[model samples]
Target: MLAETDIKDRYTSTNKNFWFKNMPTCKDRQFGWESNNKSVLFVNHGKTTLVDSLLKHSGLLGNGPNVCVMDSNELEKERGMTILSKVTSFMYKGNRINIVDTPGHADFGGEVERILSMVDSVVLVTDATEGPMAQTKFVLTKALQRDLNPIVVLNKIDRPTSRPDEVDSELLDLFMGLDATDKQLDYPILYASAKQGWCTKSLADAQEYIKNPPSDSQMGSLLDTILEYVPHPESVGDLDSEPFRMLVTQIEPNSYLGKCYLGKIQSGRVRVGDQIKALKPESGSNNQEVSKITKILLKRGLLTEEIEEGIAGDIVLVSGLKSASINYTLCSPSVTEPLPFVAVDPPTVSMSFGVNDSPLAGREGTQLTSSLIRDRLLKEAETNVALNVVSGNSSESFEVRGRGELQLSILIETMRREGFELSVSPPRVLLHKDSEKNLVEEPVEEAVVDVDAEMAGIVIEKLTKRKGEMKKYLEVADKVRLVFEIPTRGLLGYISELKNDTRGTGALTHSFLRYEEYKGPIEKARKGPLVATGPVGTCTSYALNLIEPRGKLFIRPGEVVYPGMIVGEYNKDSNDLEVNPTKAKQLTNIRTVHKDERVQLTPVQPWTLEEAIAYVNPGEKIEKERRRF
Candidate 1:
């Protein structure tokens, strides 16, 4: 091997700003994040080791790449906003560790669900103090339902106040409470402190027991356990049973190939130029027919490398198979039985991705025409089965439904970055007719709230208005843990109020729950928004001073403002009022003695993608600005 000469050079790095012009590095020398995507591997070095070792081990000689899934954005780093499941690989067990790191937030559960179907198992990580929190329950429950065995790892065991024993028992109990079957009850537990960079399989060992010297540690044990325990699914099916088969999982964009179809090869073999019929989803059972595998691709670590004759179990990419979708079947003539498909959760939230009716609709984006927007949405629907786009007219808008706010937000954000200009309506729950054909609209979701005992009643009271029903209550240390089955409809706009009510000390977790019967207009909780009546040119401190007495402003001086644009929020009952934020103050030549000179404008109320989606009023809409180039 030409080792020394070949290893002469090393490198680096994108984000929401695919089209934006490259920004200069910040004053701190740390440039804001650029691009973000799922790393396609798992069980990274940091997956088992502490975070610091991940740095050292990945760079033992040269700069390394066995790093864990991370978001470099300041907001993501500080607040940990992983709205997507980022997959990455780590070298372990003499094999590549293909792992998917799911988000801790519940809103991103859709991302987690979509990615989980790709893996065979999951390591249920829990905090020693909090044990398996609500999100842990949400993710674990889905994992168990899919028959994926969970390897439990109690993290943060190094803290002096960490109660490992209690957390262990609680975790087991939580698993049971989630309707885990007898066979799923017993799971392996590992004590770990990601900061300490150590783990042990022994339960009798002290929670504080960690290898002090970092150089003395290794990831051999964790790797060995995964290799020994996690049974690799049969990559290719029985050779004699069929010719070749695969499941269409994800669709990728390629310049030469156009669309790259991602999936797992099941059986037989696929070679380039092989004649195979595309098995349409419409045909009856055992429906797959003849088509051709135009091209074959493989994943070399995080990058996609083209190949021929890929086997089963390994995640593969293919091209020339047009119309491939999540559940579509790809098989040879010799194969008849279609693979059982993994069904993603139905979307509970829906909103209209409509033409920008705002006066400045076509001003911001190039792809602002209705036909352009429709083409983009239809293209997305063709690939992403999870997204549903309802047909609408040129004057009307398209109704898009997705699992949650984050999913819809991602859709909007992606479209915006692609030069699309569209306004979105508020997200409403997608209701359905059960087998009985009854009108069963969804209710508020189940919420797990952790708050001080003194604040418990008020939290419950606020939840009650939102059609919340209690599941069970627990008292742990100085906190009260209560679970409630709340209706999803009334929960909208409640988060901000909840944070305000609890003084930002409460923890709330929620997931979509099965809908029973419809919950009547439970309670009407509404707030007014500051609407611009006339065309705004620019905000000024003097003009803002006059408008400040009316309500709060979203745009400070120097920021551009437009009519029909929501400039601020009014602190009052449900009522939208127009205000002139750009009215220039009538100047006077006469000067007065000694006075406070400057008037401070209120800071703009910057909204997160999800929050802005939620903040949309009934007839109002959300305007998205693509990262500028």
Candidate 2:
């Protein structure tokens, strides 16, 4: 269990698990991985697939007597990225080892920061081909700063271009660069082809695999390394005699249990029907709430079993706790001391979410009312610590804020899939006042880009135009890796352009940096949008052929068009074009010229929700740019 001092370390580190009851040996183990915080968290940059492979390789995917499995979220599957941090447990040598797989993308770094506090140790997985990529550095630096002991695993060693020794050297440099402690620098390194289901602790053993490939078998070496390297929670001192306390790390809504609060018991014990109260941080006005534990749930693979109780150091899901949220402390009613809470980094991006008022409103989606949208946003705010929702001045709009564009887009995409119709404005950076209350601060991000050597110049030019200040530059083989510090506002819609500039060969990663004094305004990539002059009709190819020459068209030939809907980009000097996309050409009697006979329209480049949101500013029309919505 994490004590008050340990909890303080969590917050100061700039951030910011489970168990099973079994009849195994009944021995009081002092040095085992599962002795205290039986939990180990998996952290990576964008290697969620490796995580899935690890679970399967560990036999947690099948009914192999494992306790639990971390099921990927719905959005995670579509995006090929982990969104929420998940927990699962498996048994290794009689010890119940709880594993948490977190998001690898830099966009979800907030999730990584918050979940780091839940576990006693970490498994820092890095790619074998791309040694110490941007995301690897991002997550590793956070773990190192938290003073968490991490086991570095060179995943995907089966890749033909893998250089295990070189990557090992780079990992050492990265550790030293992050000012890692002597003990942290002496971290264990393992080589594994997670896809092939084999791992070796010895460099020579890993080298021999090239000629005589090892059989696809258990990841025993990696598992044993984890057991040997990861320290037990008991090392942090025993807190079982203290009052019951657990910081809510996550929240979920269960059909049967209503709202389920998932967290590790920091002290004492809890059981079904136990009287407990919610202890909020000192800053909160409502410091406590009287509640009773109606039911206790334990995760076992894909299914959850109803448990009678959970003791200190065990992660459990408690139900019937109303109005509790992430960072809140759930403790015994007899206890008055509130556990320390790690405050998450503030949201960097914000956008307006309003009920669709366009001509196509409610045509494609059923849930178009502001009330429904508001309720959903509020519901999300209850569980998602990275999101913040506030009611707008008008009844038709709400302001949603989050860590980055990707995070906000995921929320919007979820709503879209759930039959939601909303008009979203371009994202803006959230601003805050410094201590003196006079200087305004805007969120900045440490942006890293890896691109082909030939395209490095162009990428730098693009980033420089967006107010990105170069911090570091390195050449790795035929590629160049560049690091910059840029305002969040500059990065909102820059991803699409960056891909274009690098010809899809570049990889970009960014994590939140400290907020600084506001940087000047950033100019938009495109001049303005081609607005539709619509009476609510489908777009015609004849009109599209004409309009596409003026700019890039966004709608297809037969797609429905609506008034005020953005149809294309405005490339000309005109402020905006109210072109009639539904306009039809008159019938021609004869086909004369070769090219004139056919009205071949250019392929429409439709704007994804993220692109569209980034294209438009707050209520400013393309033609009448004077007014701000």
Candidate 3:
């Protein structure tokens, strides 16, 4: 081990080419190539070892922090890894486990693709009841294509209905469907309730496993299983920290730590003041100093703290820099090669985000301008590699695209919560060019629906009418698996409809399948909206009573409403309707006794962010303007 006291020459510079000019002296290719169709060289002389990312372990390797847990955003908490948090380290026996906690949702599948490239293998955790959700299949297929040894943790096995045996059978079937070799069937498995904090060989070891279940189990039973099967990534090449190298996996600006980056060190050792080169992931040979790291540290759960040294394959925190971008490669200035980066999927869905044009636009937000939205999105792009944003051609709007509707909606939801008033465009699929120069639209997903056996046909009929090709229908555990290859447009309205059809008991998961030839006109949503046409004032019971006769109401009496605001679904299948919010009943002294009854309005539908996003129409928008109701 290198002595901690030994020092290295270091300096900071504004030279953007610092990374390309200062290549570290090394004997072999130092960094791993990120796979996207083919592996592209990511970091040159910085030695990187493929790791399984063993998050929970029995023993530690070196002084690197052994326990790495994610501190994710509230949005991520809801969407789960639609953005991922990766904390790095190697477990005992020299195995590098770049622990990646990915979102369970398929919408954030891009995050999984990118994070998986930085490591060697994956530990796919699934609830015993869910048994390899739609995302599990999507994420696992990517890992298998990389020849990654998948270690399955049949988590939540302690539940009364948890079925490890059935799940194990299902797991093998998933593996076989993904084209796994017979050897892969010998894969290792563990049972754990990560919540309960214990893991065992099978249900039989329930007593032993549950004796203690800390988020970080120290008994080492699970870690031992991982090490036994998930072979260590052979240390590739040799590069000393005479210079330092790293990949920027996470980014944040600290009031105390300044600009910081979190990632596993590919090669060499980083000391405070070491002149590290920050290379843009897309930059082939060019690298820049941008700034210098003032400290070496590890993300100890939530925050970063100073550390003595960071080695290859261990998660690290570096500060005292200008700014670091996700997927950027940080390394010795002399290294010429860039580290492999995961290719994030192009956003299939998008929304127009601009200054909210609502009558109450400026009332609820701090910064309400197109320029603020532009600046914020640019800053987001600097960090979030998955988003694609552009100013509207007409300049009155901004076109922001992302992986899926849920993904884009989450962004809008986050901005709304942060007090930003912005109007978004209808979610649309982004088209691209194929090798044949065909005008191919963005790749849609294959929605896999698991519902009660009796309700299978409803799902099939809905997807089929929406241009979904139901390929496989299987009956298992009194539930049916109805798989469909549906366009992105078909899915927009399916979630709510399926929920209603299944009575909220159906399970659906979708992942990006390959882009097929343009599959004709995709189906639009079925329901129209009840648009309030003229005025800014409180909605009254009398006017609501007139409109409630047409469809469900979204606004109640005494609540504010404005022109161009979407009030409720029109119950019909079209757009552009007009209703009056300021309309009140005329008082007449000649009214009959039975006709004198007060106009008691029906209940107004309270809109949650997800529900509103799901309910929006092409011409109408989900306004987040504040109101008393």
Candidate 4:
């Protein structure tokens, strides 16, 4: 057990950075309580800002972009959301705490699902104004299923419209709805303003602290709470007696180390020179490859420290394993049995990635060959367990399946940024056959939408036309909360439409429910594309100006166009229109007395990777070249 010391005495006002700077040295701490404990912080969709703020205020991150240190990917930084789980450690009162920051988006739920198994406790960060959201329920359910008790943090409490009491009550109801056990229902709540770098046990204290600045940091309360509630790894078993075992949860490539496998030690200890064997538990094969550990790296404040040995419950990075992959068991050479691995939800969406057969395919990107694309995708699948790649009908294309459109789009966007030019087909839901019922079933998702009351009818009507069935509807204040169970196909291109209908004030999130009977056919009365028909040439402003009335243009002037290329959406009618966007205005010597009419074209609305993937119809493909959709 840990000692009960005065929280005030442990913290100091000597400097504003006392949160991390004033930590007790290893020499001053008691012997038994020095062990490290792991905890995870997660949020619902797009709520990573609170986690980033907490890390920055706690001194684990530095000043720069307004993104979490864990979200190191360029795309994640640009989007201001975490797409992967990241590990970092800090010292609080002479105790080491390993913190795992997981992505909030449901598309990356695989990251959260596997990460929950490595931590002993969870810190669920939620917006006070928004309360519990769709993804909040998803992640909380995963944690609850793992039997991990959560510590609730009502983040963004400083918002003017925040209602902590109401949100707190809603959280209780959410817990009850999830069928949480009695111990789980009695969760401790913290009111915090991660932006302001303060947290308190009560809403009044938090509000009072915000009004009057505190000289010392208030983040200690959170750290102290973890130490008090979260148990150490040794609590599970006697770590010193068991043989070494660890289940690889993450894999990353290192320029120097080749490949690094990350996971928490489940039993005993491992050193740099220890020999371990990688075993695939699910493969049901007896084959095992032995490898010697070269290095054990421990995460320390966003950086890793070379450690000689790692004990049970310590999340560490081990290198020198050439073929170790996610979900593989790394154990002592003497141990034969492997640890049980958590199963990830199967992918629900799939898309075909084919060689860029466009006329200008090889002009911009260096990697345009099908073989290179195949190799890159296979390498990604080795690390990203949630993604699966299989051969398509043709030799030049590969079908990639993943959790959702965002997951597949992120993969495509990442490949594009890496100089890989590939033609991607529109996303399609993966279907399943119910042999017992003798019925064809498709993937259904539970969508939770929060929008203004006036726009609820529009959202409902649009969704209903797509074969959506309303599950729940409630009016809260000036907004309406709607729940619907809709086929995944109906939601392919609906996100943008939802935003347009709500004027950008609505919040929408969805998660996979289960396979249900097909809901007949949903009408897809979408407009056709405008194809380029003339010879390849530079698009002119005059031609675009004249073509604006026919449809919405995807390209502006000064862009190169080729034959058979899709240039815009044909809005004049449902049939595809072949127009000459490259037709330059006639250069005539005769000049009229009247000034020439200026060509004013509508600004092109750019399509994000997800929107572009969702917009294409069957037999149509999105050409990814020079960042152009």
lDDT of each: 0.61, 0.69, 0.62, 0.76
Clash totals in order: 28, 4, 29, 0
Ranking according to lDDT, highest score first: 4, 2, 3, 1
lDDT (Cα) of model 3: 0.62
> Model 3, 1-629: lDDT tens per residue?
21212111111222312421242222111112121110011111100111222233322222243222342466544432324444533323333333455544666566666666556556666666656655666777778887777677776666666667888898898899999876666788877665444667766787455654454543255666655665554463454524466777667677887767877666666666767777776757454655556877654323344555565555677886674578878887787667877677667777787777777768767868778878888887676777888877557678887777777766776677776777765676776678667576557677778788888878888888777887777765557777788887778756767778889878677877877666777556556778887779998777888888788787778778877777777876676579997786676787644585677676665665655676666666666543321
lDDT tens string, model 4, 187-249?
888888766667788777887987885653467777677777766553425545778999998
Candidate 1 per-residue C-alpha lDDT over 1-629 given as tens digits, one digit per residue, 9 for 90 to 100: 21322221211111212211121111001000101111111111223233334333323322233333344333444443554334333333224445555555555555566666567777776666655555666677778888877777676677665677888788778788888877678677777666555667874553335535244444344445556556566444454465777766567778888777766556665667787655655546544445567777654334454555554454567777665666676777655556676666676778888776665566668887777888888888776666788875446589887766666777787788678878778888776667667577674566777778889999889888777888888886567888888877766666666666778777776766677678777554556888776665887777788878787777778767787777777887668888877777664556443333688766666666766766676777787656421
List per-candidate RMSD values in Å.
9.1, 8.0, 8.2, 6.1
Residue 214 displacement (Å), model 4 = 3.8
Candidate 3 lDDT trough over 10 residues, lowest sum: 38-47
- RMSD over all Cα atoms, model 1: 9.1
Clashes in model 4: which pairs? none
Better of 1 and 3 by TM-score: 3
The candidate scoring highest on TM-score is 4
lDDT of 2 by residue, 411-490 (tens): 88888878887777777788888878688888888787777888989988888888899988887655687889988887
Candidate 3, 380: how far from true, in Å? 1.7
